[model samples]
Target: MKQVTPFLMFEGKAEEAMTFYCETIPDSSVLDVTRYGSGEGGPEGTVKLARVSISGLEVMVYNSPVHHAFTFTPSVSLYVDCSTEAELNGIVEALAKDGKFLMPLDNYGFSRRFAWLNDRFGVSWQINLA
Candidate 1:
């Protein structure tokens, strides 16, 4: 089957961010972590790319200091559909570290979920358990 995954770009915190994410999400794991210097077209010790999986969903994370002409905005976000309130809360809490919340975690008329700020790395996520 064809899969669509979210790709995240970090200035210089790809490794650290991936590690943190893996620790936060249950059954989440990181695949290959490639360094720049280890191959062509990257600086030494810097992460070139990494494949991470959370609940079987794959996400790509990369480190690119050269902004060139790209930037991250809140226009797009990843929505996580959780199975339980506890799982949803765990994700919200974990992603909230050093991150601000746009909306407080609470129960809405439609669903019980939390939507909030991007993490310290500026990645926005929506956690929902319906």
Candidate 2:
């Protein structure tokens, strides 16, 4: 309970998505990664747990062994406040590839521009230009 970190559960792409986020976002990094051992429920070398940061916002991710009927939804989303349109747009473009956009980038009056989507790994995100 030291901190409330956002946790993402990927079916089998936790490591790949973590690496993508680290590379796509500025000032972001992967703090740690722990993988399942050989013959474990998960494939060897698959991420058991991983800690990563985007814009210094620390988040957790892991691969789940059990299948579920549910997945990420726009109802709950990670909201990012960007300093510039370029910053917001850059992230939106990278994330938009192979991702579904809940709301395409537009001036929603509340913000200069905004885009909401569930990223390639099925994590919801809402980016806004302040």
Model 1, span 1-130: residue lDDT tens: 7877788988778899999888877898998887877555567877889999966789999888676566566678777788888888888888998897877787776675666568778777777786
How much is the lDDT of residue 41 in candidate 2? 87
Please give the CA lDDT of all the candidate structures. 0.80, 0.88
What TM-score, over all chains together, does every model reach? 0.83, 0.94
Q: Which ten residues in a row are the worst by lDDT in model 2?
A: 65-74
Collision pairs in model 1: 102-117
Best-performing candidate as measured by lDDT = 2
lDDT of 1 at 70: 62
Give a tens-digit lDDT track for model 2, residues 5-89.
9888889888889988888788999999999998788988889999999888999998998788988878888888888888888
Off by over 4 Å in 1: 1-3, 38-42, 68-70
List runs of model 2 lying over 4 Å from the truth: none
